[model samples]
Target: MAFLVDITSHLNHLNAQLQGRDQTVSDLFAHMNAFQRKLVLFKEGFSFSHPNLAHFPACEEMRRDVPECNKTFHKYRADIETLQEQFKNRFQDFYAMQPQIALFTDPLSATVSEQPPELQLELCELQSDPFFQAKGNERGILFWRLLPESRFPLLRDFALSMASMFGSTYICESNFSTMKHIKSKERNRLTDETLFHLMQIGCTNIDIDIQSIVHLQERPQVSH
Candidate 1:
């Protein structure tokens, strides 16, 4: 139970990191790569000869009471291996697009030879430019957008396509949740048109102009 709790806690943390807005495929891939590396470290930590529970506080706590906790290390190691396999299999598509992802994330370091023939010259020029070299520090979608469309049309378009790729269903799921909240049983009478506008207002960051709207409305006139 302690082992399960520790593993679940780590998984939950990764899930939370994967959530949120403005996250491009590159950002999600970076998080996944980091988590995969952590899983490797975790597998090593579960070694029978030298158990390392630094990251697994629950397991460490149980070890204090039960020194024979190392008995479960083999099972834990197997589970970690399974997890590693699952992650690799699940993100195989991402692995296949790694070259494109690398180009989008770090054009400065990307190999010009690996890129498409049309993009090769543009990529070379972009990499050699001192102005872009300094600006290359910016990451993900924004970095791709920073490229001048007129200068590096092919490279910029390719990078933008990769950068625009959907990394997760977080935004879609969040919108569904917001929609559910807006059309709750208490507000079941809301029409589709009203609901649409309400959802737009609810999901958007734009501030409503209440005072201006109130002033524009026709007020009831008082009779003397």
Candidate 2:
């Protein structure tokens, strides 16, 4: 997997970074073990949660003994077991908190009026809702329609912020590329304010009317 390759490639650097922070090699190894465990758990969670990914063969390829995967099972077996145990404990914790979660979603429905909301419940409810159920399948915004912004302002804002979050640097990189074109070597003296507006106009999808602006003023004559 790419994650496995990335962690392995940076293992020395990661160890060095940990050492600089006054952490020992043993601690670093433990963290690395935890990281691997978390990675597997994350993959399993994705496969289990996402309907489209449920049937994805690649999601379960790590468990296979294929040449391309070439995963070292013995190296990770102990850590994997530990991670699974932690996952089970976490699941149990959530199961124990279901009553509190239900109280949070519909506070009036709670047996005890003073019960607090559960973070896990809110998130679980968000994902389980029919509107949001299909979102991760191919990316949809039906959840927006179902959200009661005025009624649940905190939940609404949280969902909207998460929805707007960029999962990768593609947009940032594209903007930088656009800036290089807009503020070229020939126009290197452009101010930050000028560059910003120029990039905004160049990068955005909004329409601009050059003719309308031209018609607002007389054209200047060039001297021969």
- Tell me, by lDDT, which candidate is best: 1
Tens digits of per-residue lDDT for model 2, 1-224: 63355334444453444443223223333455555555575445443222222223453454454544333333433544665576556446444554534433343233542333433455555556665555544322343446576545655554454345443355577788899888788888888997887788877777998567656767732210
Clash number for each model: 0, 0
Candidate 1, residue 113: Cα displacement in angstroms equals 1.1
TM-score of candidate 1 versus the correct structure, residues matched by position: 0.81
- Please provide, for model 1 over 1-224, each residue's C-alpha lDDT reduced to its tens digit, 9 standing for 90 to 100: 99899999999999999999888788888999999999999999887575899999998888889888767665789899999999999999989888888887888998988877889999888889898788866876667777788998998778767756778888889999999998989888988998998789888878997567667868822210
TM-score per prediction, in order, is: 0.81, 0.36
Q: What is the lDDT of residue 184 in candidate 1?
A: 89
